[model samples]
Target: MQSTAKAGPSHESVVTNGNGNGGAKSTPPTQRTALILYGSETGNAADLAAELASLTTRLHFRTTCQDLDSVSLRDLLKPTLIIFVVSTTGQGEFPQNARLFWRRLCSSALKAASLRKVRFVSFGLGDSSYPRYNVAHRMLCARMLQLGAGEVFERGEGNEQHPEGHSAGFREWIVGLREKIMQSFPLAEGVTPIADDVFLEPEWKLELATTDGTNGVMEGNVLPLRVANGHKSEPSSAAFSSKLDGTTGVVPNEDILPVKGAFTARLLSNKRLTAPDHFQDVRLLDLQLEEPYDYYPGAVAVVYPKNFPADVQDFIDLMKWQNFADKPLNVISTASKQLSPSPLRHLDLTHTHLTLRWLLENVLDIMSIPRRSFFASLAHFVGTATEDEAYQRERLLELANPELIDELWDYTTRPKRTILEVMMDFTMLKIPFEYVLTVLPMIKGRQFSIASGGAQRLDEGGSSMRVELLVAIADPPSPIIKYRRRYGVCTRYISSLQPGQQITIGLQPGYLDVKAEEMSVPILMIGPGTGVAPMRSMIHQRLAWARSMGLRTAGKRLEGDVLLFGCRSESADYFFKDEWHDLVEREGLTVWTAFSRPQTSTNAGVAGATDGDRTATRKQYVQDKIHEHASRVHEMLVKQNGKVYVCGSSGNMPKSVREAIADVFVECGASMAREQAEAYVDVMERDGRYKQETW
Candidate 1:
């Protein structure tokens, strides 16, 4: 978690066409090397670049894995082959490094015929769940072609769900790239050939002795422990009052259980952000962290969330565990060999010195639905029920589908079914954590946009950074008993904290270039609802930096900042409105507010505002506003060397805005829909004109 890598060089230096000493272009020193340029937000693309670099070195190709911002267009064009591995940030925007790189690439000078010798291949990574899946890679690939770069092979595009997981797809792609590279560029002397058949699996294992007795039976891969009455809601404590169900449970004091090292922080303040009339609950969290924690303006912090104690207790009751809390048991692991070691053991069912409740919440996923194999393992239990084959088939079908299983588990069948019930149903088997892990996505941290500048200060001692975080306290509509809409894990934790309560958190380094020193740089921020966290931070940084420079926040021709903020109702959810006014009045800021719900034809409200005799219209969504200012945005990005930043939901708003921009390009003129849209976004990206951070 503690990163020691030096901060990268200035963005201008990497994108500059000519050195200050001479008007002549400064070509890179490593002419024979290949540059692996990665535009990654979550480090996956970077990891892929590192893997490729390690493999390419064996091919005698001196390679360097670089962030896109570290190299200029000259360096890119000079490389024999530049591998662009990029993932699309929110709203189809480029990742931080790629944004800067793309902006510069789109500059008139770089796009001219003077540099048409670039040869490149791209591999884009994205999830299929989103509509614009792999859109970033498509954009980069098109830009390379438009700028006269030759392609060595078909672009490699990998989805989140690839080949029963990633290993197979990754191995295949790397092998293909290796073969293509070998075929294109003859092997130099003394270069060794890599083995064609390398098994791609994590290299680690653990051995533990199995426990015996009526406590539990070590079935196939999982241990089947006994349970009382089989009701999930019955607390493990109550179930064990008369008889031992043979399982154990543990309760944690604080919400967070530090796994690795936790990032310590001081929760400066917390206030209810939403109105009392609103059904949803939200909060404005202000925290101050120590210095040397540099972050970009539009970056997200990944927070690890813990399950509620009530839910943990429910899992315990079903397992029928006891007070074996501090007892010792073997912990195992089964991760791939080439990867870094995971926090927990692999294959071992028994965890050491940890309570049953602790294991269910912090370790095992208790909410995981029973898999098909699990029912198959419990086949013997079916003997107690009716022997009708139709009944068995119905039960099997129910286990396979989550929707059906949830209905039965919540309403008709109920949590009364335990491991013993499984014995009465189908097969009895031991379930591996790996198989279980797949049932639910990793419990990831909610990424909030860093709104303040890293270079700002609060009290003389603490560094000031603004974060615009969404605190969603609404429950989802689900048929499953457990899936009932409840306050989100992190949101409720944040909402419940008192002003004086010190909260612990980690500062994930920012990716966008919103440093304190760059206060004079023009920035255009678009954030709807709570997505404005990082934008607030960036604006705050700019204000603080401007104050330090003894410069007025506004009036002078200082770098202009524009904010396009959207919400449901201006009255109920206009978050940070007063603070925004203070920023504009004290520091010369401009804000554009969009209220979609209230201003709709169905619910008209709010008066129009006038600026220099020009009256602004009633509210609309952010995407419509973006189109209205499309000409200005094009000018800002293409001419004035400004940056465009977006932060918001992972759903519709961002997607619409991107599509609107793509339509603007089509209106002007471009080849295919995908190509032109890609080119335009790529232009903004390569030149540092765009940055996006969203959940």
Candidate 2:
């Protein structure tokens, strides 16, 4: 018998049942297929989905993983085991990648019983600090249930503030998920559970080819490729020839190239936006792109930073791998396990031969705070022969224990220490190279808001290119080590870069949901500090719009644009001060300034404030300003139907601003009670009139 299985929404593969004959065969039945879909903004949900796919594949199930946006509504009607890994973004909104899917799911045309035959499960990544924590996943589960889908297991919510971290909670949830899957789908005859001892199985084989002393010709014929299971093979040239003029050294094969999601960019300029004497260091950076990229006003630029050379060298010296650091080591899977459906397939290092130094410098995040599992793994390497080793081992084990999690946080997280420092402090533990790969997290990029308007002319030829960013240097106050100041990995690296220095950056879009046509409505922008990045872009865009429409300014008394900006003091940290003045004078834009720390008489004309600006004497905050203008704000919202946009610190600013807006409704007689006023504000958020991007 023959059966068709769906590997993904866009993929289908054929599976044969027993032998092609009617007679009973000794082969076990084909594994049931499973679908894993994810919606992610910062790639956390996608990472968790990939891990779940890997785990399920090892447990004798055919698995396929894809983004939720790729799955159509028709795919939801299929009778399959589906798992959703999704994350909530600002204000409990669905991630940009998942918006289309969510809209389709909420369609009125779809019947309530459309997915009655489907069985599904879900997991959410969220931060408990937010008011609408995990609302995205909760909404997803509710909609799925409304469509008559049967949930096989309880939905899992992974909180970032959890004692064991989101990853540990996800790991625990997967165990229960596997058991539920087994009970829901019975195994075929003669099928057996996989052994717990089997940790890794390889799918592809790699072999090193020697280069001849002459041209690029090899001494012997290239080895024939080994095909695993029934996987198809791509044809390749038997004799490799040099594409270069043969003057330069051998070029590495495409397989050994850096992993995807990386783009090389050159630094064009770096200018400090804040005064030299200011407490904070804010900078404006211009990056020259090697290739053309497109982004909107509020999109982010993710910069993949490298560890400091000194730090990398320190880690290598601590590992005592100086001799073997540059050695070419070929990796192949152990021959004991079956090669079909490869395990460890997600790791690129398994398919190529690379130096240990390259992996340490580019692959692993050795400076990040070590997780609980890392401590547990480190405990195994601590020798019990000496008294120090015994005590350290016991302590490491305690730190790894779930019961003593608070102590673990105090020792590792509170001090903001890195794994290298922990290893140096331990003194007796020596982790092996093989175990290092398993414990360390992958080094990822740091995201910053794109501060400039997209696509600027790079030359006289009118070739529009380059992107700009606003980055604030983060120098932690308390030193992790005595006399050694700790800097933010990405920010410090970018700050240290000189003009014409090359770096890798990637564009992340969809942060701004507003379209160009939506600029007709009145906009109220409230942003403080570097949060003004996106607001600046919006202001420039509005200026262009006004020029196009032949209007002198963006908005009038109640119909145009208004911006509320705040900082410590105008003179020291007044970002884009000249530009704001030009915009207010030429474009008829309305602006309000709040200086939190106004200068006193003794400190007049210092960094805090100057005599020219009278507003600096009041010492007011942005939230206080909002409350002071409650009547005008109410008029803009209720009488003019204006939109509100807030960008700034996530800690108390957003909550404070939200409460201040709610107070406006009550003071303006729009609502009788405070709860009703808050409800009105919530309604405005639901209608997309109130938007925020804070972090």
Q: How many clashes show up in model 2?
A: 1
The runs of at least 3 residues in candidate 2 whose Cα sits more than 4 Å from the true structure, single-residue gaps closed, are: 1-37, 46-83, 90-121, 127-132, 158-263, 329-353, 376-394, 426-428, 434-437, 454-461, 478-484, 551-559, 601-619, 670-672
Q: What TM-score, computed on C-alpha atoms, does each candidate reach?
A: 0.57, 0.74
lDDT of 2 by residue, 1-695 (tens): 11111122111122211111101222233435567889987768877786666555544555557778878987665424688999988778887679999999999998999878777899999876455778999999999999998898899989876765576567567778887766666555666554322232222222332222111233222222222233422211111212322322221111222435556677789999898999888989988777767666677888766555456667778877665655443334323322122222333332333445555555567877776656755665666778998899888878876557577878877677788788788877666554445445666667887777622314235464577788889877653465556667677666666677677677777455656665667788898888888888777766655566555533432236777888898678878877766666655566776778865433322121112233246677788878877777888887888888888776677788888898888898644589998888888888888888776
What's the residue-level lDDT of 584 in candidate 1?
56
Which pairs of residues collide in model 2?
A: 555-560
- 393-472 in candidate 1: lDDT tens per residue? 45654653323435444432333333323433333222222222322222334456554553443444554443434455
Q: In terms of lDDT, which candidate is strongest? A: 2
- What does the lDDT come to for candidate 2? 0.65
